[model samples]
Target: MAQFTFEGDFEILADPQIKLVESALQKKGFTNGKIVVEPVGQKGDNYIAHVKRFIYEAEDGTTFNMIGKVAPVAEQLRLMMNTMVLFNNEIVMYNLVLPKLNDIQNSAGVTDDEKVRFPACYGVVTEEPYEFILIEDLKEAGFEMLDKMKPLTNESVRLIVKDLAKYHSLSYVLKNSEPEIYESYSNKLSNLWAIVGAEPEAQQFFESGENDLFKMMHDVSDQYKNVVRGSLTQITPIAKKIQSYEKGSKYSVIQQGDCWNNNILFRLEEGKPVDDVMIDYQLSSEGNPAADLLYLIFNCTDHATRLEHYQEWIDYYNETLDHSLNLHGLKANHIFPKDQLDADLKRYGKQMVNLGVLLSSMLERESKDALDMRVMTGDKEKLWENTMAQMNASLLDISTIVKIRQRIMGIIDTALEFGLI
Candidate 1:
């Protein structure tokens, strides 16, 4: 992890970056300003970007707060992630896809309160190899991330899935009404799963797959190690299948792709999450709606919650999506009928099992070491060695191990039930 303090690293701000900010603020009616940029989140957490909180004070004493997300300054990191097509997709998302979705919702007579909200993008620099987007700071707008350290309750899960339904439904409507536009948008996006799955390092890691993390599952089942191994091996095949965009698929939409607790921010009222917004669209791509739902379920909820109310949660998502589709003068049957949605779940559910094993371990692990490991992109053996090291460190925590086991077992059970294993 690199140390980035406001005082020592203030010189890192280039004149061009400041100029970009000034141009963006001028659009919002701010004239002649003094701009100060400070580091915002953990530098280790964001391996691909330099996230800065920008404070612009106008000559008239008016102030504007915006987030400037810029590409990594490190040449090696930037080149590696760029080859994987990471940063530019987000630039496309905030600039193109989100505004289009908002317009589609507005035309459908959806109220602002009910609409799926994205932060307002003030400006974007789409120059290749130096992409960044400036959007309204959600924290200043009263939105906060659910504590990543705490387990999510049923209510938080409900809000997350419900919001995801609305987000997916708009794309459904667009796919049905204007296939060309939807096709173009989906084509422009990248499937992040494919990038990771296609990595020789990842595949080799899956092969050499006896995990210390899985050792903690001794009380759970004898098959735990094999289940983890087999699921990881399947990531590449499933990702290739999804990214193929084969003909005769009944439905697909541009998913947020990354759906962990960190990427989602919520608005709280009386200590409960009332409304939520999603951020970090670098992984956005065309996929089954089930991809997003099952990912959220396995990563965010406990085993008991899913076992008890899985069907209910699925129904709720469909109902919300259906209602939104109806408001847009479209029938759910024409866009995403119930039967197709069911098939999608069965087909794509295995991918969630794969993701849960990898991501749950990641969530529980030490953050700084994990970021340090990310730089070893090309070395398959070294990356796997470091990954196992991180997992071993996390296994020392009994509570984290319990949660990891619960999630892994739940996913494995669901995958078996859905005939995905």
Candidate 2:
């Protein structure tokens, strides 16, 4: 059999990265005779990293599959993403955090089926300038991705929210049951938004879109124009605000930083989602869980579906969270309390509005217009000058812009009605 087959941009994967995967598999008692690698999904669309499936055939003919993620080979993207830290954080999540979480739940007598599930991480390599993660490939268990372009059904949204609740509640358990572990894990997690705040180019990128977004909001209401403009200009500080861990608050959790549709995989039966598994923890950090809820709604669901089920979605998330916490022998009311969660959502949900408009442009933009890391730099003016024109072109997708605008306007109207903004 041929050895070390590759597809897509897997060509750029260097020998050291491959060796890391082999070492990870070897540690699991899988001695390989030959290995095959194939690209799993679309690339470049993911501006930060590339993922591929690795198939290993043992000397006895037994074979297993692993999913691997590696930092981008593109020089510009690598520097822009601060991928070293991102890779290290994810490695810590899989190697350190997941095991602690599983142990905490198991000791509480929680059954594996009822608890939140994540892929088994086989091995991790954190050597600087060449990091890769190897984990169990969930596709072998029939998990699949929903089409990101389509609006999520309520059923799909419910499944996502439920799983998110289960995942987030573990942070609560860790904090109360195992404070030291909680502090250690929480402290290590890098706030993903802080990266954007540090990068002057990134800040200006958000600023450049203000006028375009303001013009889009002009027809909605005069106040909307002000709201949109204010949110856009203050993107850096708002991002910083969410980064606060707010220790001992009911609202805080070590949140899944990137909660878009593409970051999740679902197990569907008869065309309906039954369960989901989360992937891509590169942006994981401590923050208000509501930001995750709002991010998923605004980024994944179309305006119509989100508006139709906004309240129901919140109810479903809180219900699931309550269930998850009770399983850990912790009372949600005493520790987190459902009523406080409602208040927290109102406080932090504007992230959905601010990042919703800013990020949706990237989500909807043509693949060609995806951030070209090649020219990215710390020099704000140079980065802005090099990027602003093409960035505008990317955000000009009418369908995407309209849908995002609808979600933001809906959020604004509700905020105003509730005196939230």
Best by lDDT: 2
Taken over the whole model, the C-alpha lDDT of each candidate is 0.72, 0.74
Per-residue CA lDDT of candidate 1, range 1-421, in tens? 1111222234555656656777777667666656667777662455566778887776678877888877655454444444337766787788888999999988877898779888888878766555677888999879987767565777888888888989998887878878888888877887766766565655666554435545666666666667775666777777887778532255778888877787888889999888888888887888878888888877877666676777888899888888888888777777888888888887777677778887766665445434444344434355466655544634356665676676677768766764655
RMSD of 1: 4.4
**lDDT by residue (tens digit), candidate 2, 248-340:** 455578888788878889998998899898887888877778778877876777656765788899888888888998887777778777777
TM-score, predicted candidate 1 vs. hidden true structure: 0.87
Residue pairs that clash (backbone atoms under 3 angstroms), model 1: none
lDDT of 2: 0.74
